[model samples]
Target: SQQGEEDPQALSIQEGENATMNCSYKTSINNLQWYRQNSGRGLVHLILIRSNEREKHSGRLRVTLDTSKKSSSLLITASRAADTASYFCATDGLNNNAGNMLTFGGGTRLMVKP
Candidate 1:
């Protein structure tokens, strides 16, 4: 089984600043996914890039992948107060008993102050 690990469990940034977070995985994966949780709410899928892709961008979110290193990074540009939430990365592997499942990291809590 594979699991995701994130660094700097928490972060604080100004409304207009950029927020960056990193995630590492313990095993090979088919794809990596980034999600955001608004306080006590369920996670919302932020982005999903395949293993072969290097970088992906969606609005203010940018994700980078390094398959050789088994690591990924998420960058949130021009933050806003609404962006304050817990971000997590999930690892997806093909060989699994439960079909397509995601192993989530502890998460990085981001606080965007106005």
Candidate 2:
């Protein structure tokens, strides 16, 4: 089954500020990943947290997963105008895990002003 819902469809912040997004999924997920998209172009993977992982961080990016709540969150710090883009959360689970079918969240649009 398909699952994953992102909160706050849109957000606006200053260049030096920070942006945070949340995601919720319905099924049992093996892992959760965060991606960033510039304009309307392709997406770039930011971070991935396994179901067993509670939190992970990469540079300015931080991700947290709570299987108990079937939810996850992504945080981007020290934002820049170049960071303006859309973010998405993807879940890998069941018959649709990894190389199989991929389910993604609705996505959150972030606008960072210089």
Candidate 3:
């Protein structure tokens, strides 16, 4: 069953602002991943944080995970117009099989004005 849930259904920001998004899940997860999609097109993988890790960063993206709370958050620093897109958080169960199943959240629409 899908367990990921994203917050702030929608967000609007300026060219150089910071944007924060949140996600919550309902079950144990091996890892949580964040992705960005522009105009309903292909999704761009942003960052992935393992359940054992507290926080991770990649360039302008920051991700934090709290297994106890079954939640995660993604932060975008110095946002740009290109950052305008739909954001989603996905979680993979703790199954150690070669085939992994990913459950994605509803998604958050972000609009960054130029």
Candidate 4:
């Protein structure tokens, strides 16, 4: 079963604006990873935040995880047309029974208008 699910299935923003997306998951996780996929392309690794970590950042991307609420949010600052893509959240179960397996969410499609 899928562990993570992203909200606001779609988002639209203008270039230079900030875009935010949220994800919620069930069960405990070892780590959560965010990924970006352009239309007709492979998924690009974004950032990963461990269960002990509350927040993480990489370049223009900011991610916050709240295990208490079983939710996480990703913020993209200074958005550009190139930032337009589908964002997904993947989580690895704490049990580790599946080894390195990860469950992915449906993802949110973002459109950045120039």
The full ranking of all candidates by lDDT, starting with the best, is 4, 1, 3, 2
Structural similarity to truth (TM-score) of each candidate: 0.95, 0.92, 0.93, 0.96
Q: Scored by Cα lDDT, where does model 2 land?
A: 0.88
Please give the CA lDDT of all the candidate structures: 0.93, 0.88, 0.91, 0.95
Mark the regions of model 2 whose C-alpha exceeds 4 Å error after superposition: 95-99
Q: Write the per-residue lDDT of candidate 3 for residues 15-108, one digit (tens) a residue.
A: 9999999999998999999999999599988888988999999999999999999999999999999999999999998863664688899999
lDDT score for candidate 3 against the true structure: 0.91
Rank by TM-score, highest first: 4, 1, 3, 2
> How well does candidate 1 score on lDDT at residue 61?
95
Positional deviation of residue 9's Cα in model 2 after best superposition, in angstroms: 0.4
Q: Which stretches of candidate 3 lie over 4 Å from their true place?
A: 95-99
Candidate scoring better on TM-score of 1 and 3? 1
TM-score of candidate 1 relative to the true fold:
0.95
Top TM-score hit: 4
lDDT of 1 by residue, 59-108 (tens): 99999999999999999999999999999999887665785788899999
**Candidate 4 global lDDT:** 0.95
